[model samples]
Target chain A: MDLIQKSLLQQVAGLHDVPEGAYNIRVNGQLDSRNTTANIDIVTKEDKPGIDIIIKPGTKNESVHIPVLLSKSGLQDMVYNDFYIGEDCDVTIVAGCGIHNCGVDTSKHDGIHTFYIGKNAKVKYIERHYGEGDGNGENIMNPETIVHLEEGASMEMETTQIKGIDSTVRKTGGDLKDNASLEIREKIMTHGKQYAKTDFVVDLNGKGCSANVVSRSVARDQSRQEFFSTINGNNECKGHSECDAIIMDSASVSASPKLTANNIDANLIHEAAIGKIAGEQLVKLMTLGLTEAEAEEQIINGFLK
Target chain B: MDLIQKSLLQQVAGLHDVPEGAYNIRVNGQLDSRNTTANIDIVTKEDKPGIDIIIKPGTKNESVHIPVLLSKSGLQDMVYNDFYIGEDCDVTIVAGCGIHNCGVDTSKHDGIHTFYIGKNAKVKYIERHYGEGDGNGENIMNPETIVHLEEGASMEMETTQIKGIDSTVRKTGGDLKDNASLEIREKIMTHGKQYAKTDFVVDLNGKGCSANVVSRSVARDQSRQEFFSTINGNNECKGHSECDAIIMDSASVSASPKLTANNIDANLIHEAAIGKIAGEQLVKLMTLGLTEAEAEEQIINGFLK
Candidate 1:
């Protein structure tokens, strides 16, 4: 195995070897797609350097893991990945990006993803963006994702970006049909003048559609961040957005959460908060003989987890 | 009675007669220091137009109500009031300011208050700042308050400013000694391009001191607001700060709550949030036959109260 694959697996999949040919892996604009299980297949896009995943109707019990890696500095990777899950299918996908910058120039990745869920389908997706380098190059990621859920469909996403990234802009939105539900849980951490801005908009377009967006972030040193989330209700739906951040030193954070209800039965609520780590939490650990820095590290790990 | 006196009585005291000489009242810039007890006396400052009240030792069962008023438009008033609370004393002070502007020019008021509480003194202070006018003049107020609590002393302050003020900047700070505690509850509401900024800094300088500062605000129709609070813990102390705001109709708000601890036993926490009104809250009220405006008004009243 090459250094690229080794680092990618460790950072993203947390595995030693590939999923025994049951998954797809993309490395430096190269794609390796395998395992045609009669109902699920990965096809390369004709127009772009990306992949198109299709799940046939009634397909079930399929798990796919795709980890993308950007290993060289001055390299920029862009992928447009789309997923089409048919009716009554249940699947899980583990997707992530790992970047290793080793030069003076910046290493950036832009992952644009779209998901289409058929009626009564259930999808669980997890994505982690990790950056690790000792060079002066900046590790940047800008992810744009959109989800379309049919009636009775449900989608749950867990997205995390913890440490090592210098800059990021994440945009995620979803449109839910009747009886459909969507939930996103995001965690972010930045330090040493790093900047991150995350924007989210969820539209409850049909009756009984529900959406919830929850985020936790930590900004240290001179890092800066902005979080904006808006939930628009068009029917008898329920929506809620929440953001919590910890700021230290000269760090700054701005959290703008808004909820708009157009129908009389629509219900939406939003909340955001920006502050420092609790002193009591640190003291509790200190009483157990941990240093302040150790206590902060433990707290951040717990918060992000 | 003169028109100024009538307006002052109605605006500040909420009375037709002037307390029938039973209480101390300050109308506009005049000081009425009457009904002096052997333990409590209100005296005019030698260098300033304001007054100072000195409470001798063993003073108990004394209450003071002094509501300042700014009735004339284009008129600015500045007052410096000081209170010396003696040991073993229990007192309640109701101090507030009301402005009725009705002119083309701006009317302003600045109040600087200081309190010195001795050991075992329990003080309950309530202050409300209100502005009401139908004119083009801007009603502005800047208040600076400092509290010094000795050992075994406790203080509770309830401050509110709900309507008609165009602009304000409020700054409050307190220093607590051993076994001293301070709590502040602030409520503010603004509309129609009004602006307000509140800053608080509490220092828990002695052992066993605790402090809590909580604020709630409503900003509507392009109004702007900012709330900044920081509690510094230096000993075996406890501190907490919280801020909640409701933003509507293009209004904007920024809340920054912070805590700093220098001792191993210090414990501090802060939380803040900003968003629009929840749709379910409105629906619950509207189901009782109230219109949207009526429902919103009811919610705001309940929240601010």
Candidate 2:
């Protein structure tokens, strides 16, 4: 029984420590620490024709707390090479972080994440940043992210930036590849004095590539948030981007989504806006006796849902 | 000449005091006053047909601010009936207000405003809102506006929401009319902790009516902002709405633009987004030796140009 339990634990901790014909990164973590976890990959030390990468957070040496604001060292290193998904091969990567702290004082943090997805391989990554500290003193956090996508590959990435010490984030990422597709989505909500900034850039280098970006923000109290998304269609590629931000109470949100078409043949479409819960809809619900807050809640719930 | 200037001022002021067949509104104080403005024009007083109204703050009382945020108000009361424009009749209304003492710190604001257009009339209205007094407290505001259109009437509205005492705001509006058209444009910029929200909605109710809405937002510092818009089609109406918001430093923005089709025969389109000045575009200018900020400023100047 003990051997069996140990073997299961090892498998969960090292899900990505094997090489498959089709590139795939399967990450499963043990609930040992709140801030840090182990990374296992069955990558051969020998350099070859495969993709080369140098993760910024690297393997942890003790539970490291992401700072409220990113530091110079945090984002200094660039990944060695763009990850290549061999032609006709499928690749999927799931990478995420667990952030939790318990205390009364304010907290600030910054983190830098980088990614390079190579040609012909499809990669899907999920990123989650979550903290459990109660809203207290003014806290600021800035996190930066960058991504590069190569030709004939596809990527679907989603990020969830949830409650935490008041923080701000500046994230930058984009893709480049022929016939490649990238889908990016972010869900953010904050309270206290948290302020956040995020930026995304998509570059289509190969023909037939596509990009889709979406963002949703929810804020309350004195908190502030902002989102910037730029989708560039180069070399006759197609791109579509959408962003939505919702504000609650005294909280504020600002978002901009841009689509730049460098090629006349490029098919690009973009849409973005900021708004509160609809008044007419609220009235319709209120006529049925639902309170104002309840109506607002219903709208938000619908959006998030 | 002095007498002429005073007479002109009096005439403009008088146009606001009493609603007229010509589109007109005058305010001695802030139109966003929570108490009075919240319920302004909620129910069209039958006695005052052809005159649309809105509730706003009274400069006569220093105690009231942002009166348009009423806790209990009916949907119909928040709207004004058709303010007609006689066929080929040329008319203009000058509306301006000085507002101070808002509730939210580090916010942007757009006063609640709504409009109604009737058949065969041409109407023009210009509105400006500014902060007065010491500007000590942060002022946050949300203004709601809707426009109703009838056959063959045309309307144009211009607004500018500038500098504040750390205010935040959400402004939302739209139009509905057949053969009637509406044009709206606004410019906004903010520093300090000011955060702002602005939105435009257009619903073409009658055949051949058209609508256009355009706006821009600029923000700096730890502030935040957002813009949401929808250009909806109905009953063979045609409309378009466009918006852009720019962010600098730690500032942030969120925008969502939606194009909805209510009638298969109607044509409607809209675009919205928020983004930083492009880096590569700036770098290209910098390669020619322009400073980073100067390059960016030049790009912005070109965009505005």
Candidate 3:
């Protein structure tokens, strides 16, 4: 199956056709596996570059799709995926990474994921990162995620870095424990001299723990972005962090959302907003007839959907 | 007159006694032309440093209370006031500035006000800026205001800078015509190494002009703060700018709320937030038994009231 490995598995596992029962891992220029079942197990680390997914301990309905590809062109890769997710499980994970650089140097992807989930687990993690060809190269993604939820665990992480990725430094973090709950939804879009930075953290550690982190971003033209989120409410936990951005031409955005509490029955909140783009949302989509660059590309695709 | 000019006329013109029909300008240690009711006219320019208030064209029931003070401690002051609101007028302006430094050196105030609003005028402006004595000096204030709204005029501005000011740079601006409307409510507070910077602008030129800017701030300990608000929607206008901040400890805060829409039937919106404080609002004010610094001084006096 080649054609750039079926277009990087239909741009990151929205799989054109390949599901003899889910669980897949197909990294184009190297280790590839498929139709993985029997409660999950995928090994490909003869001591170095990436992959060893465990998952099995009661193992309820499971589904996984790990897609990674960087079709030649000054390749630079470093992957190390390790996820355990054991006790009483219910899972759905579809991780992504794609770059299909056509030349001119610089193609990098450094993914280091480690999730240990455990006690009463329920995880739904979906990730998407992409970039295309006809390239003057440089498609970089450096993602490092570490989550360990434990007591009555629950995690719903949905991440998206759509459109051609030029540079990214995203680090997702977690640790929630007693009655644990963590939800993160992030969507981003960048244009031109693109560059993105996201540093996230959520540590409500124990006693009815909860955390919700939300982000929505769109920056066009001279893109440069930064979203730093920190939510920490040590014990009687409940936290929230939010960021919303839409900036056009000569773009520049920086949202620093932070919340830290030390008991008093911890409860935290953070909010960030950067503006531009709301002339009545492009005059209500040009009164339904478009134009004005098609109503700013349909309001940046409903603001990165 | 003396006793620090009767405590700078009872802490900035809430004059312990001085009435007889309205319009007042009492700038102690310098320009004091008290009890001025002839429909506005106060001039003091022996060639330099500040004061020219004019408003006379068919002036109706005018009520103006100008407050300015700084009782000793090596005082440094600058004031330039100019306002002329004529046609079909209705006015109420209580401008404020107070500082009452005690010793060690540094007491400064710089105020520059300019407003020209005519045509169907309706104005209500209330300002309160204060700083107390018992000082090791250093209580500075710099304010610059400009407003101009002519055609169906309207202006409602309420500003408050509470607590002891140590440093400030506040610049307020406005310009709106046709069915003009402008509302500004700003409240600020700062602790220790106090430093505050507020830059604001609102410009919606004509047609159904509108603008609203709301800001609330509180920065504790080693204080440092910045809030920049900009709302510009030229023409079929409607604009909103909001900033909310509270950061404690080694306090530091920055919020930039901006909205610029150049008419596609302009409608703009902006929101900003900086966080800290709020652990369920200090556990519902310590379950009503107060303490926790009296529930954070009763939530910073109801968030700067």
Candidate 4:
């Protein structure tokens, strides 16, 4: 990998060098590096432009890193990645994408990821999207995530998009079986004239199943954002979804959360809030000798922390 | 007062039998009783169908009660009441209105109140609106409040509307001078087919002026609600506004909060949120053997508490 690609990897995946354990690095829509451990296997698909990561049963304390970097402007990249976890395994997956476009044409990436977890398996997924460039072109990313959890399985996913993405549409869907759980945390910030749209749908299909999805975002300048989430409780299950946003300057935000309960014991709820930074918060910070702009920056940093 | 009139008074205000420093009771469309103290005076207006309440300067530890009751159906009553608060005084004003409609026609009340607070004075105002009847008639209320605060003055207002009102339009406006402050807390609940609308505009017109406005509401059973609040920081001042609501069972709520900062030192913010109760709250209560309905009711009660 070149210096720019390595820098992009550091920015998106926190990888300063070659990562440990199973890892796959893709740069400019081509495979740059690949490695596999004793408990994990990474294989390229024959017909598709992606890889399949398979983890052995009972694997513990293992990790996988798949980071993609696009340093070539005007490149349109698409990839399909799938993960399969064996029963009673616990693992962590880090997947991120970064784009450095310094040309006159737009750069775009579309990533489709699907996860299948066995019974009693546990997984934690972290994904970050970032863009940096001095060119007039735009950086755009669209990500789609699908998950299926068996009985006694659990998955926690965290996704963040904080800077330089000119446009994005993110979609996530999950289905949980008996005693299974799914949790998702999403954080996004849009500045300039950027636009962001997020959609999430989770279904609790069996008794004792639960799902929780929460999103926090900030929109500044003339940026616009829309968040839509729906939770369906089809049995004796619990589901909740929440969206919170901070609006600044001429920014606009709209949130719609819907909940459905199809059974007597099913319970579902949803909440959404959109607003600006509280005056009292700013005043308290300003009283501590910080300028208004400094106070605002501190508040936003803490909020997105 | 008759038994029904007394009961209405008790419901709107905390009055069993009026015994206070100064009080005025209006039943239906006429005056029921009036009393005054050495420092506080309540006089019937000669040009209108309301009263003027005047408090002497330097007065302390005084209270006033002006409660209005409407028990006659098909009656549309409109009155203009004004308050003149003297400088260096500390006072509490209890004002409320109750309507009991037991006929086939609509009962409506329009109360227009204007307050002039002098310099260095402090005031607390509480107002509650309630309606109860078994007939097919609808109950409607339109309340308008205008406030002007002099230098170094402060006012805190609490208003509530919980039950039985079929429709309402509440409007409040305030202007704050140098070193003046205003705080408002509004709570409302709408059930059945009831409709409620609230509008608030506050202007911080001088140096060191500030304003804070907050509203909490619950909409249930097809009820509709709209909340609009605007805070203008025209000088070296601070302003904030917020609207929070819960929507349930086909209920719809829309909130629009705006902030304007005209001066370099002006700080302004606004926030709004609308959603449903949390499912975990219900599950927690249900684990204690409470029914879902009971848990829901308890959550709503505590939220509006």
Every model's TM-score: 0.62, 0.44, 0.40, 0.60
The better candidate by DockQ, 2 or 4, is 2
Give the worst 10-residue stretch by lDDT in candidate 4 chain A. A256-265
Q: Please identify which of the two predictions, 2 or 3, would achieve the higher lDDT against the true structure.
A: 3
Winner of 1 and 4 under lDDT: 4
**Top lDDT: which candidate number?**
4
TM-score of only chain B in every candidate structure? 0.94, 0.64, 0.39, 0.98
lDDT of 4 by residue, A190-273 (tens): 999999999898888978999989889888888888777767667778777777777777776666565554454565555555
Poorest stretch of ten by lDDT in candidate 2 chain B: B59-68
lDDT, residue B131, candidate 2: 50
Model 2 per-residue lDDT tens digits across residues A31-124 = 1112212332223224522123322222222111111111111121111123323343343443333223334444444445555655565656
Could you report the DockQ of all the candidates, in the order they appear?
0.06, 0.05, 0.04, 0.04
Question: Can you give the lDDT of residue B82 in candidate 1?
Answer: 94
- Please provide, for model 1 over A107-215, each residue's C-alpha lDDT reduced to its tens digit, 9 standing for 90 to 100: 9899999999999999999889998888599999998889999999999999988877899999998999999999999998878988898989888898999998999
User: For all the models shown, what interface RMSD does each have?
Assistant: 8.1, 13.1, 9.7, 8.0
lDDT of 3 by residue, B135-157 (tens): 58888888888899888888888
Model 4 chain B — which ten-residue stretch has the worst lDDT? B256-265
Per TM-score, what order, best first? 1, 4, 2, 3
